[model samples]
Target: MSVTISFNNVIKKYNDKPVISGLSLDIKKGEFFTLLGPSGCGKTTLLRMVAGFNSIEGGEITFDDKVMNRITPQHRNIGMVFQNYAIFPNLSVKNNVAFGLKNRKIPKDEIERRVDHILDVVQISQFKNSMPENLSGGQQQRIALARAIVMEPNVLLMDEPLSNLDAKLRVDMREAIKLIQHEVGITTVYVTHDQEEAMAVSDRIAVMNSGVIQQVGTPREIYQRPANIFVSNFIGRTNIVERSLKKVDNRQVLIMDENYQIDLDDITQYAEEIIKVSIRPEEFTISDTSEGMAGVIQHNVFLGINVHYTVQLSNGENVEVTEESTLGEPLEPGTEVKLLVNKEKINLFHYESEKNILEGDSYAK
Candidate 1:
């Protein structure tokens, strides 16, 4: 059965310097949770703590009602897959997948049955007898996964399992991993520095930085309503523009460079001050006739599905914008245009704290 993992005020230190401190989190049973961040941001440290590879300096780590701070790695009933496919070089695909069960001394018939089932589950059945040397990187990873899951461990830990594969193979394997995880129904804690990969596979993601969790939520929540500026910048690309929020007609009006005015809210309480606006590329509408913010297209690149544009606003600040590819030709670099912001989708942040001022379903409650 899958187990829920909990962390309460967990702390880890290196040479007396705290690496991860005061971290408290909960992972639901059978949830695919990812620890995402840049290197040295404590994501891997946290994962190691969960695996019992690193000692906790403070707080308790628990599996359901049982405290695991003193548990040994081998006794944790956890399976691990690493970036380097840790396949036994001397063994064939079948033996590699059955290694764990064989160690546990399961019945010969039971081992064969489990091996066959998992090889098929991972779609590596055709190469069951093939040696690790003869298989591709992707195939080797399949062996690793099949080996881990065949034991039916309650928790699965994967640390950048796709980092060694080629780009296309990474995408394919991520999809494969997601489907297999749901099918097997095991609680997962994945660690990675790749934001896109984390989002694609995780049921929920914890964004960490400098040993602190910046935010934890579903992909959509973290993207749309980030708790702070660091989170808004980390999860995806955004254009942060300095703007003044003025109360005009008793409504919150976002004033840009004394040239553009857009009403942000009429109900939510916002003190009039200089604020930072976080607008995503897709949250902008660009057109020829003047309707909103005035800007000149600086450059344009047309990808197959969308067109990317860099526009220089009147204040000389440049912002990126993305629009759907159209039948019309791409706009020239010097072309004048009007940029319309999607007020409903934009995010406002307090200048001093850099925390998102609007943090609810519709910007703010």
Candidate 2:
């Protein structure tokens, strides 16, 4: 059965230097949760803690309301898929998948039945007798997954399982993993440094940095409304530009530059003179008339589905804007354009704390 995982004020350290500090998260049963960040950001460290490979320095980790901090890896009943595709070189796919059951002295017929079922579920039954050396990278990963799930552990932990595959194979494998996880209904904690991969597969993601979680939300929420400047800049392409907010009489007015201004409606809490705002590339639209900020196109590239443009503003700052390629003809480099920014979608972050000032709930905190 699937189990809920919880981290209650968890802490980890190396030589008194805190790697993970006071982390708290609740992963629902049958949820595909991901820990995503750059290298040395402590995502792997947290995953190891759950696997019982690393000891928690402080706080507690629980499985279905049962504390698991003191449980050994072997006794925890957690299955792990690693980055290296840890399959024996000489063992056939079927044998590799049945190794765990054999070690546990399960009945011979039971091992055979479980192995065959899992091989078919992973769509690698055709290669059941093939050695690991004869399989492709993607196929080998499938074998590893089959081996892990055949034991029917309470939790499944995958550490960068697709990192070794080619780009196309990575995409295909992630889709396959997503499908298999749904069918099996296992509570999974996936670790990855790729944002696109995390966004594609996770029900909810915890973006990490320096051993701390930066934000936790669904993929759309993290992409559209980031909790801080670090999250905005890390998840996708965003143009972070400096803007000024002024109290014009009673209402707050945002000055993009001397050329463009927006009147805030109910957002009266912002009183800072200068604020940093994150505007996504796809948030801007080209206008026929001078309705908004005016800029000159510096460069344009055709990306088949979308046309990417770099616009130089009056302040000499470059802003990126992407539009549907089928909208109209692509703008040339030297062309002048009026760009309209979507006011409602723009995110304002405090200059000092770097926390999002526009949103009421702060995920980082």
Candidate 3:
């Protein structure tokens, strides 16, 4: 059965150095939760904690209502898939998937039944008799997944399971893995450093940095309204600019630059003098009208469906902008342009905290 996983003030240390400190989170049953971040951020460390592979120096990790701190990995009945396929190289696809069931001494017929069913579920049944040496990297990974799921474990943990695959194959396997996880309806804790992979597969994502969870939210929430400057910069391409806010004629106006300003409605009265803003590449609208922020196009890259333009603002900072590609040729370098930002979509942060002030008006407090 699927189970909820909880981390209560969890801590992990190595050689007396704390790697993860006071980390607490709840993962719902049957949910695809991903721990995402760059290398050395403790995401994998935390995942290993859940799997009982790593020791917990402090706090508790629970599955449903059971405390798992002292539980052995074997007793945990958790399914784990790793970056390496971890399938026996000498075994056929069918045998690889049946290895776990066989080890448990399950009845021969039952093992055959389960092996057949899961192989189909992961779409590798056609390669059942094929040896691991003959199967593609993606196919072998499917065997790993099928073996993990066939046991019907309480939780499934995948650690950088796709990192070894080529770019195109990584995309394909991630989609397949997400689909298989849904079909199994098992609680899954996925760990990955790839942001796009996490966004694509996770029901909720906890973005980690320096052993801390920077933000926990759906892909859209994190991408649209990141918790801080780090999250905004990590998830996608954004132009973070420092701008001044001033009360102009009884209104709070944010100066995008000397040439452009936007009214900060409602909470404007409480805003600080200096505001940090994260404007995603798509948030900027390019126009020829001189009324908006002044910029000059430095270069352009054509990416089939979209054209990415590098614009140097009048103040000398360069920002990337994305626009849909058209039949017309892209504008050449040295083109003068005007840029307008989507006020509602832009995010404002506190200068000192680097935290999204729009999360709750800092001045209003």
Q: Summing lDDT over every window of 10 consecutive residues in candidate 3, give the lowest-scoring window.
A: 356-365
- Estimate, for each residue in 107-200, the C-alpha lDDT of model 3 and write its tens digit: 9999999999998899988999999998899998999999999999999999999999999999999999999999999999999989999999
The regions of model 1 sitting more than 4 angstroms off are: 363-365
Better of 1 and 2 by lDDT: 2
- Predictions ranked by TM-score, top down? 1, 3, 2
TM-score of candidate 1 to 2 decimals = 0.97
User: For residues 1-365, what per-residue lDDT tens digits would candidate 2 score against the true structure?
Assistant: 79999999999999998999999999999999999999999999999999999989999999999999999999999999999988999899999999999999999999999999999999999999999998899999999999999999999999999999999999999999999999999999999999999999999999999988999999988987899999999998999998999898887888987778888664668875799989999989888887878899999999999999999987788999999999988999989888888887788888889988774433243
lDDT of 2 at 99: 96
Candidate 1 local lDDT, 1-365, one digit each (tens):
69999999999999999999899999999999999988999998899999999999999999998999999999999999999987899999999998889899999999999999999889999999999999999999999999999999989999999999999999999999999999999999999988889889999999999999999999888898888899889888999988888888778788865666887653266758888889999999986555788889999999988999999998899999999887478889999988988888888888999988873578444
- Quick one: how many clashes does candidate 2 have? 0
Candidate 3 wrongly placed segments (more than 4 Å): 266-269, 359-365
RMSD of each: 1.5, 2.5, 2.6
Q: Which candidate is the best by lDDT?
A: 2
Best by TM-score: 1
- Candidate 2 global Cα RMSD: 2.5
